[model samples]
Target: MGLHVFGHDPSGDTALSERALIEAVDVLIFCAPIRQTPAVISHYVAQAAGIEREQLWLDITSIKAVPVAVMLTSQAEVVGLHPMSAAPKAATLRGRSMVVCEARLDKWRPWLEDFLAATEADCVRADAEQHDRIMALVQGMVHATHMAQGAVLRELAPAVGDLDGIRPFSSVGYELDVAVTRRILASNPAIYQDIQFENPHVAPMLERLAAHLDTLRDLVRQGDDEARDRMRETLLEQSRAYVGEQAIAEGSYAFERLGYLLADLHEPRYISVFLPVDRPGSLRALLSVFEQRGINLDSIHSSRSADGDLLFRIGVSRDGDTLALRSAMSAIEAEGIGRVVDAPG
Candidate 1:
């Protein structure tokens, strides 16, 4: 924690050249995006040649095989690290598995393991090829499956302008799927593309998936009860093997949370108001309007624009207060207090 951190950004004002940065640091960590990882590592690795044997080079790329192979060419000790979770929160990282692939030597392993343990992450030692193989299923196949599902939904159903339209008939599993699908779709598409294209094993995995889907389709078309029952049992057994008992056990609690979320969605929604920073006591005045109506605040987030206008996103929930919220929002809009936007369901 006390270590002095120096960053080199090529486009920034305080940019240090790659050679300078390489020479200054004992440990060089490449945190580049998947597509740029090979080139970035190679560029620095070339510069770092014959510098020092004590220097340790590492990469945190999602796909390990290629990057670890490239890193192995470097004179310095190379370790391939992959944090399993995206944008790791405390709960996600703590006791979570982090794959560490040994490419070259044991010198940096202890330090890396110590650092991972300090963050409460479990270090999983794996070969680069093994890591990539597992990732083909973990990342590649999973993403492809969701992408296919989303595509099917778009082709079959009406355009989903509002997510709320589907909520009424949705199960807890559907809600979870939507949440995960949205999260994946919101991320950089290039990263997912790299995962799909870069992993050599993904093509075969996708072929197998397609074959399995075809089998399922044939089973459905045949309408043979015995065959269908066997297929169902096989699917469940395979799922249990993949996710294990813990996920099955936690599903009840997940459903309970889904119930609470559904109930909240049915309640009166929030109005996100963006007010000018120059207007003093505007927030207090708006709060008073809710207070007068006996409505309670649910949540609030504040940010400032480039022009210094205050963006206040407030959440208000009521059991049967939609009309009241609408009237209050109309009044606030009329007063030129702020522009009010409906919060998404």
Candidate 2:
């Protein structure tokens, strides 16, 4: 049976078809594949022919201004919500910010408040124009910039042994770029494309930046110090204008918070071997042995090493000594399971 937690809708009511959605729903939430379609509102309106003005209409589009404009004439109290969590494969409402923009927010304010609070979300109230303008930079421009970097790297990677003398050094800026690139390469590309096309302002900004980057690259190749200096100063000035020193300080605070969280969940240390096994079911057999012996594990990380061995770190359970754990592992024929050595010390 279908349940209605908030409203008085009957349980076991058959699901409404698309044609009947507008009439059936007390509130209509429209989520599109992309945020910036001009036809989105008209489409919703037509689908919802008999929907009353008293019914709540909402869209969770990233850029809100266009949706708000379309819904303004309708009798329905319209609101736009943007959830600010970094998208996981399947993200739920938890730990996400839902920014809301409303015309006549008072009418649906209670329902909105109740819905968001249930999910433990932070709610920021803003209007259509303000929301879109912020997103133009936040999603659209940011994605475009990273895409450009990825493109450049793909095009300009050096051949193996080409940089034998070049030392690898790390800096905050490089670390930031690493994080940015990691996100870009790992995520879906369509999301980036949607951000570009959805927001009207994104394309032009990306184009101008791309042009400037090309010019800068040319200047560097030509050994033009004057051009390079000017470009650097302009870029630095823009960065400062966008996010000041205080913003960096705030980021540091967030980093420390993450460190504290890690410490709170920290476990005792032990190690595991990640070598390849000729026999299947080796990992299971080894783990079973530990289980049978009542030897617990702490934290474990496993990855492939450069030499083609599986590398693993298994932290010892707080209650067990290393010797007992090693003995359990030995009974499983740890070496035959491709472990190089038992309890490397």
Candidate 3:
């Protein structure tokens, strides 16, 4: 068994240059941060002056398309691998998945299988482009959406530095929210950035996401019963287009289990805003200002504070011009009562 360590070049770990390493090895395993794959590959190739194409080259990268493309063109035979989990302290990979792409199964099947068997991992094959596209939605959009929610929550309550055990939260919904928060908070920013930006397929996925939200926002502002009904019909129709009608029905049923009514209404999305209110009437006073401006109350939810203030989620119909609505709300004399927040750009 032959192995070598390649720490960061500046960290003073003594290792051969890229050329020496590539030329001297029969099997080369390249492991670097997801964003540093191109740089590492370039350096290794530059140093490997007389290396032949017969060497077994493998890269463990988060996104596979770009790396696979680069490796396939190199002199060496390549196998793209993505380990499904990252554990710095774990001793064995008992239940891990190794995503493999562009594998020469006919030539190296036994060697590859035996390597995975020793590590106790299952070798799952996938197409390079397909894997990245799936990951764009699975990792990119999901993480970005959760980060947006966490940002909205923080803007609502600037005082609460952490949310380990927040109360008055729904049992099921709060548990899911906590999981989302933890997942995003524990991740590296550069990894998320590469996942979002590297894959070409992600641009269209994100475009569709923004377009869907814009449609929903516009529908909420119209507020006509007929228009709201039409919007629901359109949304259900769109969902059925992707998932079958039965699947759409099943999803609607599942959503109900989490206490969501799924009513079609033109209500402004609310974020929890914490501000000082002397009494119950103070909340009502803010509501009166909105009511006077022809904003109908779709829902008004509240949370209490230790100093007698209440955090109100005043959901009102989005009517009139957006600028006019903001100006009207800003004119309220009560300092720090509420503010209209801009969604993530």
Every candidate's lDDT: 0.78, 0.66, 0.66
Tell me how many clashing residue pairs each candidate has. Answer: 0, 4, 4
TM-scores of the models, in the given order? Answer: 0.70, 0.63, 0.62
Judging by TM-score against the true structure, name the best candidate.
1
Task: List, residue by residue over 1-345, the lDDT tens digit for candidate 1.
Answer: 355666776556366777888888888888877878898878877887778478888888999988888877788898898988775523336756789887777777788677777767777899999999999999999999888877777775577644567777787678777777877888899888999998899999999999888888888888889877868876667877788788887986778877766555455566667775446788887787777777777766665554545666666765638777777777777877777755535
**Candidate 2: tens digits of C-alpha lDDT, residues 95-145:** 567888877566777987777776566788887788877787788777777
* Candidate 1 accuracy as TM-score: 0.70
- Candidate 2 lowest-lDDT run of ten: 1-10
For candidate 3, write residues 128-179 as lDDT tens digits: 8888988788777887777777887777645654453354434656656657
Assess candidate 3 and give its TM-score to the true structure.
0.62
Segments of candidate 1 deviating more than 4 angstroms: 10-14, 89-92, 159-162, 237-345
The candidate that achieves the highest lDDT relative to the unseen native structure:
1
Worst 10 residues of 1 by lDDT: 87-96
